[model samples]
Target: MEELLAQIERALRIGLTVVVAYLVALWLASIWWTFRDIRGRTTDIFLQIAATLLVAVFSFPGLLIYVILRPPKTLAQLYEESLEEEAFLQGIQVHNSCPVCKQRVEGDFIFCPWCQTRLKRTCVRCDRPLMLRWKMCPFCAQAVYTPGSGEAQPQVAGGQTSAIPQLRGADPEDTGPGTRPQIAARR
Candidate 1:
């Protein structure tokens, strides 16, 4: 029984050794893949290679040190940093137009000259004018303007009734509910 117990202890130690060695190799490979400089040799590559070698020779503690010393930057963080640099190099100014007359207006201006229409921009969907304080479109229940193509058009006109007749063809009883209205008959 004592001999069997000794054999089990030896097996456990060997298994642990193999697992530790495999983990060390995997970590080293990951570091190599992550920091491999495809172009000219970079400081990051050199540091990672050195850390990998240290971990391979020494083990878990060395790998722990490497992880603590250097961490990867997220894509969003890198993009934001680049944007900040660009904004710093090239100054950015926003241009706004008068809602009523569609005339160009200064970003700081509060009123418009051409239409004297309160210098407000109306929501294309609901035709409700939005204030500078609004974060969203009040009329259409949409988010604020983004840098893209022009606004979408509304399906129906507001407040005004059309002078044209409602029906452009024979009565529904004469034709059928599914039949399309005739445009020439109205003329």
Candidate 2:
């Protein structure tokens, strides 16, 4: 009867030893997880060490506390979010600048306020602002006249100016794929 009691005590002790070893391994794994997770979430080495030590000292309960206090987003997630916001702002932002003075300007300004340079001209038919280099007003399809040139843009069908430039002395009636027409060049 004494031998049976001794055998039962030895079996219980071995089972307890295995369970303690398993718990220690689990505690170490929790500490490693905390360290790896904190590293991904933050660039601070101190925070990573603190989080790992917290789990190592207090085991599962410390891990729970660390989880509750950790950053909501990882470092990669925060960076990606910032990049997305920047792209969104750039897509909506309109960059306008004065060509003459190289200063920032509004999109609708016809003259540069800083240098008084004529940035655009007003369309005669539609009264909308047009760029100086535009040969015809896209809004009204009317020919834009140059301020000092002594020539006019030739009118095509529907009162729209022809984009094709005519030669110095080509006939207007010779407007075909093979024949080039002639008209006065508008400045």
Candidate 3:
């Protein structure tokens, strides 16, 4: 009976030592990780603490649960998510205006149904949606307009006319200069 008791006491001592070592290691690791990145969420910290405690107490099963339930986002993932959200918010339509005809158009329109004009264009630099008559792409400063097409005029480089000029109005000869004909703006 004495021998059995001594063996049990020895086992208990070893188990306690292991548990203490595990806890100390976990605490130190958590502290180190917390300071490394301030942007980590509260849920992440809580999960880490829970995972550490469970791992120390129950070993393999606890680790399996932690792995399965923990968030998949790394610092890079968090940054990407924020960037995507910002882009989405920025692109949200506050108002719709036709680029080609300079008319008010519906935001959901793929093309200007009235004039059969393509309202969207790819920016040369960023490849984002650019207005067909855009003098300079809002997202990328690429010239998208052409003269004589009633498109918005792009700013001349060095104030020179070397680049294609954007058309501001219909040809002067089409309506004789002396006619003084009434003109209606598209939008």
**lDDT tens digits, residue span 1-187, model 3:** 9999999999999999999999788756654543343235434666556656765565656556655665666667788898866544433243465544556677655456666665554443355765444566565334444335332423332123223222323442232222223322332
Clashing residue pairs in candidate 3, if any? 147-167
* Candidate 3 residue runs with Cα over 4 Å from true position: 37-117, 120-187
Question: In terms of TM-score, how similar is model 3 to the real structure?
Answer: 0.29
Off by over 4 Å in 2: 92-187
> Which pairs in model 2 have colliding backbones?
none
lDDT of 2 at 160: 31
- Report clash pairs, candidate 1: none
Per-residue lDDT for 95-140 in model 1, tens only? 3665555577665443466655343344433546655445455444
Give the number of the best model, judged by lDDT.
2
Count of residue pairs whose backbone atoms collide, per candidate: 0, 0, 1
Name the candidate, 2 or 3, with the larger TM-score value: 2
Whichever of 1 and 3 has more lDDT, that candidate is 3
Ranking by lDDT: 2, 3, 1
User: Can you give the TM-score per candidate against the true fold?
Assistant: 0.31, 0.49, 0.29
